[model samples]
Target chain A: MKASLTLGKVTNFLGLGFFITLKDLFTGKLEKEEFKNFLRKTIVPLVSILLFIGLWHLGAKSLYNIEAKFKIEKALQDQGQVAADALKTCMVSGESSCQPNTLPSPSQVWNSFQSLLRDHNIISADKAAFIEKTAAMNEKRVAAGKAAIVYTGRPSFVDQVFTSLQTVFAGFLLALLIAVPLGIFIGLSPNLKSAFNWFIQIFKPVSPVVWYLLVFMIVKTLLIGSTEDSSFTISFISVGLCSMWATLVNTAMGVSTVDKDYINVAKVLKLGTFQKIFKVVLPSSLPLIFTGLKITLSVAWMVLIAIELLAQSPGLGLFVWEEFQNGANDSNAKIIVAMFAIGIIGFLLDRLMLMIQNWVSFDKTDAI
Target chain B: MAYLELNNICKTYGQSDGETEVLSNINLKIEEGEFVAIVGFTGSGKTTLVNLINGLIKPTSGTVLFKGEPVDGTSHERGVIFQNYSLLPWLTVGQNVFMAVKEAFPKKNKKELHEIVANYVEMVSLTPAINKRPNELSGGMRQRVAVARALAMKPEMIIMDEPLGALDALTRGNLQDEILNIWGKDKRTALLITNDVDEGIYMADRIIPLRPGPNATLGPEFKIDLERPRDKTEMNDNPNFKKTRNEIIEYLMDIGNERKSEAKEEYILPDLVPKDFVNQFKFGR
Candidate 1:
């Protein structure tokens, strides 16, 4: 019993308490108070979400009825008595007849999620089959001193998710690369800070769409003759430019406001300029810089959709846009699924950054 | 020859409009392995003087020489213990001391350096919390880490700027004894800057009073001739301790009175309840 208790304690400390708490509750080992606390934390949120879905379901059903009525009235006006009776039959026939273009039910969205997963799997299998079918031809071409043909099919939904992840990461990395050194440079000297201040102020508030246009123009010019796709480069540059300001501003602020005593400590230690910066300034300013980076990452994710939509890039953003334009029977439901996916992914990304920030920072207050 | 020397040191803040002279025409010399404390009220430029000695800041005029060499900038020869406990919050107590030890003795191997850090941490009885960050430690513990970090560097001289001023009385006295114990072992040249007169008398061989600013200067030096390893409670009974304490307090009081009179020179009365009402009240109308 003692051993099990210790194990429970260890798991709790490691933040893997959910499973252990569940097990303990089921096994009648958990105290009554703890079980109450667990229910309050977990079941409360679940019940609220269920309630939200119920309201959406009711609202959607009413909207669907309204749309059916509108279609009936329109048919009666266009084709007189005969069309009115036919439209009445269509409404009564339900699944076998015309369905109104209204908000999808919760079940429809769930079915869409499952269908997208199935589609992703089927598309992946098709790609595999295509690759296998082309293998012999490709081998012959390689032997005949010709380059092998590459598969150029549309990306699956899962593939699009990965593409969005990759794009955002690339953009975030580029932003960090540009912002940190620039921040340090501006932070170190008042002259440099003042020199860059006007440029920063003018450019910082410009929208990502404007940035995308500027990047697109430059990239189109540079890659005019090149066969390489320029969308990735254009989107990344725009994302980097739009998102870097938060990090840049925060890093400069953090660096400039580092405590004077720490600076004095550096001096008393006779630390060289390089050592002082790396040891004192950077470490001290890291909490604020991390905060900026978190903001920049979220900004990058937010800006990515517009860039992808405009650039016609293959990512989740483009996926959402394409689904909206598709306007098929299930497209609305698929779009709803995508919306939830984006929100959940954004929340997860923020949580991931928070975990890293907490790990790096000595101050526990920065955890939130 | 003095281990550290300040010849006609002067420091001024700003220029042209609103120029304030913090220190003026200060001359001091300290022999090798001597512990000296400069005591004064707040804004008396004791910190500025300590900064000058540590080479963290420069004197606007006059030369500060360490071992007959003119101080141009900061060096590893002087290590300072700041009042605010200048341990990097991100670094553990051990790491804070290790950083200084590593900087001071770059040639020392990793194991040897670790030993140095551990030794000093143990000196302050913070061995258990050596791996803890500054935020996790109490104020006294944080200050102890600061002390350990400064001492671990093993600088030629130690400069403390009110190191224990923020700590409670019990913690302050305990740390004072710990510091004295460490000092007794090596007898390194040390200068403590503080406003507490008794703290100066207890810790240093000589206590120097810095008169109130603006343009604060050293007033007089009171030597504490009490025996080594002095007991805090027993010091109350010691005649020499009483004499030194009285002398320093009397000097401080005189300077305090002088400052009050000087402030009165530029005094102006407010028109509270009207001047006529005050005159009427005075005349019992």
Candidate 2:
């Protein structure tokens, strides 16, 4: 039985791979040279980094004057000074850190990033030791009673990315659950629709900031009032509310515009209410509903980031804010990386939704 | 007793200034298994008369009786074939016919129902296009589907409101023969409303003419004592057919001429001139 199961699995995998390859070939997406170029570009950088580390291990790995290059050290020191000043001002006065901030240079930030990656056992034990040794030397200047300034203590970029992604998905799913059915109901009955129309119109155009503030206050009052929890709840609520509106409006419109003839046929056939809605009405309105959902998803993404910025939630928006405050340190380089990551992730999310939409779409022409 | 009766039926629309009377005191009786045709010019209340029979519209002052019971509204007992072929466009031809058959015989199993519907579709010669939608087929084929649907219902009376009027002449002739053949078999009571004199003469046992109307009434009934299984080529050679056709044509022509004269006078504008201006012009002359 086990052997047969293994054989079945292998066959299934081969079949899937064959079809995927065939599809790529048919669509003219299988450019071997381009794929090879991508592999070369990606591998070359990592290989170069490994070779650099090896070369350092062989030549002047120990007793190297880590800070003797004052030209580079001076530039790094100036950046760190600016970052410390900005952090002091923001923490002391509750001021924004976005005002005319100085940022660290690429090489300086790259050195710091390498050192942190090497020591954070949070990532690996050898890297954590390196980070701890660097931090022990650096923490002599940090004031007492403040948070510990351990160089090895920084959170992993991957962990931050995963945390943000999880929150976005959770909020998006909640919005979908609330919006789709509500939209269908609104679309079906004109009177019920009209009754709610004014309220939605008024609320839909309001800024995410307003929703964020409202949620913040409510959650603060009713739930555990820690800043992190409050911020997360507010950001989630803002995205949900804003995204929910688009879905609701679109769903209703799609349902309302479903062909009248189909409804008449349903009536003539004496289809039960459930059958009429699920089989006839829902299927016919799917295209419009999906269009609405796609728009809502995009809107929700933007709203989630904006709300996070306002609420100081632990996501990409919060990361951007923290980097802005730590203006001239390696944080600047981290911010740029975060921006790229956010953009790429947003695009992938939209493509994922589009794939789902196409899968569920009832277009007759799509039949095999 | 007549299988269907329209006794002194009058249908009017709107109030005094906007009043439009469609039918006026129309009296008619159709015996069981008899085929009758009502012929009229366009807008002459033929459709209204048919609607009255099918209970699509109620008479203002009179009653329509199907087997001596007043027709309150639409019913399964009276099958109607609309002029525009109102088949559910999404459903296939076989499905459209099957829908009616199912409604008429709800207790029948799926296999039996399918066979019955298929048989009727075969009778209409629409077996090939049974799976096609109305839009997919030609107008003539769509009407054939409509015929199949009505016939499958096996109603006591079938009412057709210009079912073949939209078809080409050749197709019309073909369907007319097909309808007559079907009528001959079951001898179900059938009433057809048409504008074609030859069609009425060819297919109906009796032809009734509805006069032109603000309030149209039945003008006369001509008994078509011709033998069944009518051949159009042979119909012209029959002396009685020729006489009856001519008589009906002449009656229609007379009515048309009278209508033209009345229309002309009603449209003629009276000249408006000042009396003093006319007197001054005469004096100057």
Candidate 3:
């Protein structure tokens, strides 16, 4: 019995529980009924992903043909049959210059992804070489009463990704700091909750762009004499303001809804105010607080893109916006890549919060 | 003077039109080192009575005096064992006990507190499950942990508000005996609020009935008048035990029947019909 339990634990540890079920079936350790379930679980999602890609490829091809036909007609009207025929020939030859501007195919996106990585590498190398060559001059300048010359090289795609992560984390921390204590105080008092209810309701649904503009107005004035950029600060502050409402509301709800029985126990113990909140109320309300925090994180990530774009911050949002306006053949592909990056990062953040929640919560049921 | 006294206690919620007078004119007194049980049926405001005594909630009208002084807020001197076994789910049994012991005896050092916690945990035979969280333990085991935590405090008075009500009969009997054995050793001023007549007779020196509410108050008290280390098997045939038990059950049934009869109201359905059916009835019938 213990051996099987250990085997089950190891299977889950490696995240191969599903695969092991199939293995068990093949080895006659599982029933035919379970094998059918295994097939349904594994094969259905794979087939669905393939079907989605197939549909996307078909749509892209149709849109490409329409664009090509329109170009050919425009060339015919403006430059005659000979020119249109030449244009058609150029298109038929599959020249990148004459490529139709439309939704890119899966292969085009894959190629664009590779190109971005390669570009990042080249830029990284150039920055390193520039830093090394300028080291002595920068040192001499610093030794003197003058500022050292800094690298003005363009940031790579990976650099922008890192910048975005830093901004979001800053925003997430800021939101947590502001929301939790305020929420606890509000939750502890009914009058305070009533007073703040309008404030939360008014600001919660405001657009991220508007929040960015507000932060920009405040931060730009605050940093008027400072040489450092305020765009990052403004973007992150906006992201925090935009995303903090969910956590604030959730924390309040969690705190207010703590079990009355637990409060009685606190009373019976004659715990001081701090002990009552920390030992009894907080522990009881932690699950709901985590639920709120998860929502806040997702909101932070979602609001960050628009805020970054508005604030002109160096991040994924700006990268996607710049690519969109550049309108190169590969620019659309790059935006798609950014979209995937945003989704994966948001998913990872949610998983991270869940891990922390599970660690703190004594309840042993698997977190959703 | 009595160790604890409730003078003309009344507890009410809301004001004016929304007023709910849950308990009214409740008066009781218990001397120190005496075991007293307040017996009642479900929803007889027994918890409200307990809360009044423990200072969780205050009486709307009267005052509760403990040791010749007016009761204010909760204190370490009066420890409560709640009906729901209000053990903190995050803490293990040992930690739960440690928290109570720390609060009850603030001067004790860490080693002394640990010793107190360990002793109580052992007393309840929960040392095996000492490291297990409240959620991991069975209902009976969790109640035992609560019992350990309350005892670890070593309060002058231990108030139990139907602590074993949720357990199965056998488990309830086991916890009752376990609690009795501990109480026998100390003879603290203990107040038990329970619905069980057998439990009251078995545990308390005196049993008082909390008459059923909308305005519940204490009924007449029954003196157990039995020898210590009261055996359950022997109580079944003890003429005095049988007589007290019968009297309590009969009084409870009488009040229950009276409450039922009093609560039976005349039914008057609204003089209305569905719009569609009304038209049909008016046109055809």
Runs with alpha carbons beyond 4 Å of true place in candidate 3: A1-37, A132-149, A364-366, B264-285
RMSD of each: 4.9, 14.4, 4.9
Candidate 2 stretches greater than 4 Å from native? A1-368, B12-19, B44-48, B212-214, B264-285
- Which residue pairs in candidate 2 have backbone atoms (N, alpha carbon, C) closer than 3 angstroms, thus clashing? A118-A127, A119-A127, A119-A128, A119-A131, A120-A127
Give the per-residue Cα lDDT of candidate 1 at B199. Answer: 90
Q: Per-residue alpha-carbon lDDT of model 2 for A123-224, expressed as tens digits?
A: 656456766666865575454545554543445666556767766777777778888898888888999899989988998898888888887777788776
List fnat, each candidate: 0.94, 0.00, 0.91
- lDDT per residue for candidate 3 within A177-204, as digits (tens), equals 9998888988999999999999999988
RMSD of 3: 4.9
List where candidate 1 sits over 4 angstroms from the true fold: A1-40, A136-145, B265-285
The interface root-mean-square deviations, each candidate in sequence, come to 1.1, 5.0, 0.9
Model 2 CA RMSD to the hidden true structure, in angstroms: 14.4
- Pick the winner on DockQ between candidates 2 and 3: 3
**Greater-TM-score candidate between 1 and 3:** 3
| Cα lDDT for residue B134, candidate 3 | 90
What's the DockQ for every one of the candidates?
A: 0.69, 0.06, 0.72
